[model samples]
Target: MRTFLDSFFILCLCFTTARSLECTRCTDYSGEGCSQTTSACPANTNTCVFTYSELRIANQVVPLTTKTCGNDNECNQISRMTLAEDTSFLRSSTCCNSDNCTSPTPILPVLDTTPNGFSCPACYLINSTSCQSTGTIACRGDETRCIRMSINGGATFSLAFQGCSSANICSMQQYFNGLNSQLNYGVACCDPSSQGSNTCTV
Candidate 1:
């Protein structure tokens, strides 16, 4: 009885083996090679690695001077990339009101309607449509804050300022200049020349 059962099990195993088919590989539309889905392989059959750098601001100036990498240590004293070919990285000031003690807005206005003095700390709400990247504006005085709104009603932006001295349009113009320089780095599509006070846009 044991021998008969062993022989039966062997026959069943052979039958199942005969019914199974081998998997086939397609050529033109094969999902294995780079031609179909796995495109752009790395050189030397290895993966590619990328490194990105950013700027650090301190004391209203660039902080880091050099960068070095080791097994456990990494360099952080690098600035933003400059336009010069030789200078791969350049340092720039961070957004105002950082730990470095530089104030973002300097002027403070007494009243929203009347421009009394240099208004730096004061906040002004503006419409998203009229306050554009390429528009001209005149300042009422020195210590006031200026804000611009996004075209799509996305976000509100405060002016990047150093300090306000008088209640003149010059203070406002300088604020616009600094704001333009900073925004130009990120938004290339937005032209800063359109926002200048002295310059006229045609």
Candidate 2:
């Protein structure tokens, strides 16, 4: 009877050892010993274990992907309105054939100086066509002129201050400055009784 009990105990030990061999170790994915509380099994014998430092180094070696302007309005914000070669006009739905589409905005010359001091709208210009001026035009004596595309979709003309010496002879010059910088688009016509020549006020 003692011999039978000893054999039974040996059989139970063998079963426990077989189960431990199936899972091995939980650390370094060590392939030895029974880890009762872990869900992980021993890693493949041929593969190296990934350390925390190794994971961090591998992460540093790669870049993560990101998104920009994923939606429609955001998409429109970065879109460029090609002028001249593509000659696009920023038209609101009220001015467009499609009632749902907003018009493309115009591309203007960027200036080193912004039009401040006076209550002027923000100017839009690309890096290549930025203006190189530093002076401001007063309402009467000083005048500043710059060429712009036509508002009527024809010629790239000059939109400048006519020097308010007198109110009668205040017609601003519209020129063809060989740069092909003309305003050939449409905007609301400023009433003659309003300020400026109302030439290219888009």
Candidate 3:
């Protein structure tokens, strides 16, 4: 009976395996062969997105690009927000939706380095009672809000980030909260009119 059931399941699986969409997927440095190849997209995902990011540390920045399949709503939004004053953030993204339709190395939006006259305390502290504000950073582009994020890794690890954020991120706040594997996150955003007084504090 067990052998017969296994065979039946295999037949069913084979019959239903080809229904999902196909998309090009890879993550590589810009100009270093980013578009690798195509693959079957996961269930319910219908759009492919090409994301370019500038990851900034204390004094260094690295550019990265990735192609992946996701929802249609994610395609329309392009935003830049600084986590802990440029610790790590998805600087920009462009998307397309079609059968096997990821473009060849989409261009990243130029970062608006011109400060728009916004400031927030910045810190990227790992495992501490509180993350003190290192200093204030000038916000650029649509980064008009101050953001504070706390991530609890597990029993022994905790991460904290606070800095300037884009208004689009405030509108789509739910997406960022779900990233932690441990499912522990706390995020708060405040507008420019508030003087960012309380939002920047740990």
Candidate 4:
């Protein structure tokens, strides 16, 4: 007869097999030519995710792409924010369910340059958690709300962004908050037209 410890070991192994998944993981800051490698997903992550993001500051544009394991709620979503006429941020994500299943590259949303008759204070900074507004910037497209986003994880990782953004971007507060437990994230939003509106402060 098998010992009790043998049966328990078998059960644990079966549970691990049922929960484990393998997925591709990599990040491309240049947004191109990112080679992929496979890795096992965490027990809590169920889907393989591909994400693309573009950040425009003045005349400079930075693009990033990433593939990793995530949850189902992060799939097939796009988020956008316009801090000024010449500065903005956009991100999109796609997902798959099976092991090593590569999902299609996410496409960025069309840019809208038309002025939306709104404006807000704007600033962007890295390696710091506080920034003073250099000046005001005209909002564009559906960007009607002034917003602020901050992330801090240590001396090497810190970001502060403030400007005008679409209301839909505010909906990502919960998602951003759930991103990492070791990091601090803060998001605030308000109407720029409101009296004494200052949502972008620090």
Residue 153 deviation, candidate 1, in Å?
A: 11
Scored by Cα lDDT, where does model 1 land? 0.20
lDDT of 3 at 16: 17
> Between the candidate structures 1 and 3, which one is better when assessed by lDDT?
3
lDDT of 1 by residue, 69-146 (tens): 111111121112111112112221111111122212111123222333322221112222232233323323222223
TM-score of 4: 0.71
In terms of lDDT, the poorest run of 10 residues in model 2 is: 47-56
What stretches of model 2 exceed 4 Å from their correct place? 1-117, 127-174, 177-202
List, residue by residue over 1-202, the lDDT tens digit for candidate 3.
2221121111001111243776666665443546666776656666676666656656766656666666676665666667554454544566777777855454556766677877878776666424767687777777878877665545655666678887766654344432223335566777866664434442
RMSD in Å for candidate 4, one decimal?
A: 11.9
Clashing pairs in 3: none
lDDT measured at residue 75 in model 1 versus the true structure, 0 to 100: 17
Would you list the C-alpha lDDT of every candidate in the order shown? 0.20, 0.19, 0.58, 0.67
Off by over 4 Å in 4: 1-20, 173-182, 191-202
Off by over 4 Å in 3: 1-20, 29-33, 36-39, 42-44, 83-90, 128-130, 155-158, 171-186, 194-202
| Sort order, TM-score high to low | 4, 3, 2, 1
Task: Give the winner by TM-score: 1 or 3.
Answer: 3
Clash pairs detected, candidate 4? none
Candidate with more favorable, higher lDDT: 2 or 4? 4
Going through the candidates in the order shown, the clash numbers are 15, 16, 0, 0
Better of 3 and 4 by TM-score: 4
